[model samples]
Target: MFSRFLVFLLFSCRSLAFEDTYVIGAGDTIQISVYGEKELSIDSLNINSSGKFEYPYLGELSALNKTPEQLKAEITQGLLGDYIISPKVRVSVVEFRNVYVNGEVKKPGGYEYQPGLTVDKAIALAGGFTDRASRSKVYIAQNGSDDNKNKVKLSEKVLPGDIIVIEQSFF
Candidate 1:
């Protein structure tokens, strides 16, 4: 029984680990900068539905399935090897994909996700919960691989593209 409990604890901790990298998604805005290359810096470039961006000097580049760091490295290499010498590149996400919040909230709709958003914060952004909201039972549907599916009873951390459903309180 003790060994079983230990195993459960380990698994629980592992499941709570947040993903270190953000997958480029549609509607996200990215900022690309090349050190000392003011003409090449692009700010607030929207990621199209195809996850591609029209980067300066680089033409079109696919950002989907790539992390910000990875994208930065790729852009740097492309510029240095082909265009500029010793290009220093940096990439940052200015906006994330919208997340949907529905059921029992005062305003049920899509909300923009900020860094480190929690379920409670999301509810507040939707103008708080209605009187009939079941605060104890909140459901979240995350978009990603099958292994990412979670049916959290009361999760604080909420990711982009997550669908949050608040049931009606029976009381």
Candidate 2:
């Protein structure tokens, strides 16, 4: 039983890491640094709408659906020998994708996405909805999805670049 519990714990941690870590998306800003390569380092870079971005020597690489660790490995592999004899690359999301909150919220605007942020937490960040807000019919429109927006429960995980709206109750 103890051994089984330990295995479960290990797997759970790994699962949480992937679920919580920010996936690179359009509009997210990344900071990249290559050890020993000053010219290749950048403080901030935007992932364009196409999920691709330009890098020195690398030209353009798609960053969508990838994590920072994955991007770092990609950059390091691409720069090896051609750009640097031994390249150690690091990539970090300086600014994650925004979650837009509109309608019935005190502050209806975009807020920075945080790891493990849920729909309820986002609504809290927007000042906990208005007096006439309907908690049950909270709408979420995912990025890249069209006409597929649907109502979600409070505990639903809000991904980056999602638009949330709190419908006003007809009380």
Candidate 3:
């Protein structure tokens, strides 16, 4: 019964953290299309590990934490003056970041990130916890230089590029 409640809470946090428009992050590939502009349409434009993309006209643009629509608006704004008038731009994610799960997990490796990913969902992707895994001692470690690691509930929302560490139980 308690485990079931945890699952419910996990999904709730997942939905809240990841809604319709997912925030773009580093290592994500985005496809951009500008209506009627052949030169502006780009495919498989990968955001570098530093969260930047070298786009046409706009040069290098930051792609960290901005929604696709927000990126589209920025691109359109950049193309206005000398290039296009009222550029109808669209940005779509070609691929998302990969999340890693290590220690005490069955698989213990990196997995592709989906829209609504939670700690439990990531653990499940990693083939669930091992026999010695501690259910209440899991943590989410930010893989970036920022390093915001902390103990987390199974219900905690896991972001792309996050590292879910399932510590081992003593007993």
The per-model lDDT (C-alpha) reads: 0.80, 0.86, 0.84
Q: Return the top candidate by lDDT.
A: 2
Whole-model lDDT, candidate 1?
0.80
| Better candidate number, 1 or 2, judged by lDDT | 2
Least accurate 10 contiguous residues by lDDT in model 1 = 12-21
Q: Distance from true position, residue 152, model 3, in Å?
A: 1.3
User: lDDT tens string, model 3, 1-171?
Assistant: 999999999988875555346888778888989889888899778887688767877788887889887888889889997898678988888788899999999898989888767999999999999999999898888764336878999988877888888889999
Tens digit of per-residue lDDT, candidate 1, span 113-142: 886788888998999999998988787878
Give model 3's TM-score versus the native structure.
0.80
Better of 2 and 3 by lDDT: 2
> lDDT of candidate 2 vs native?
0.86
| TM-score of every model versus the real structure | 0.79, 0.81, 0.80
| Number of backbone collisions per candidate | 0, 0, 0
Question: What residue pairs clash in candidate 3, if any at all?
Answer: none
Residue by residue across 1-171, what tens digits does model 2's lDDT show? 999999999889975685446578888998999877789999988888798878899998888888888888889999888778898888888887899988899999999988678999999999998999998889999973648798899999988889998899998
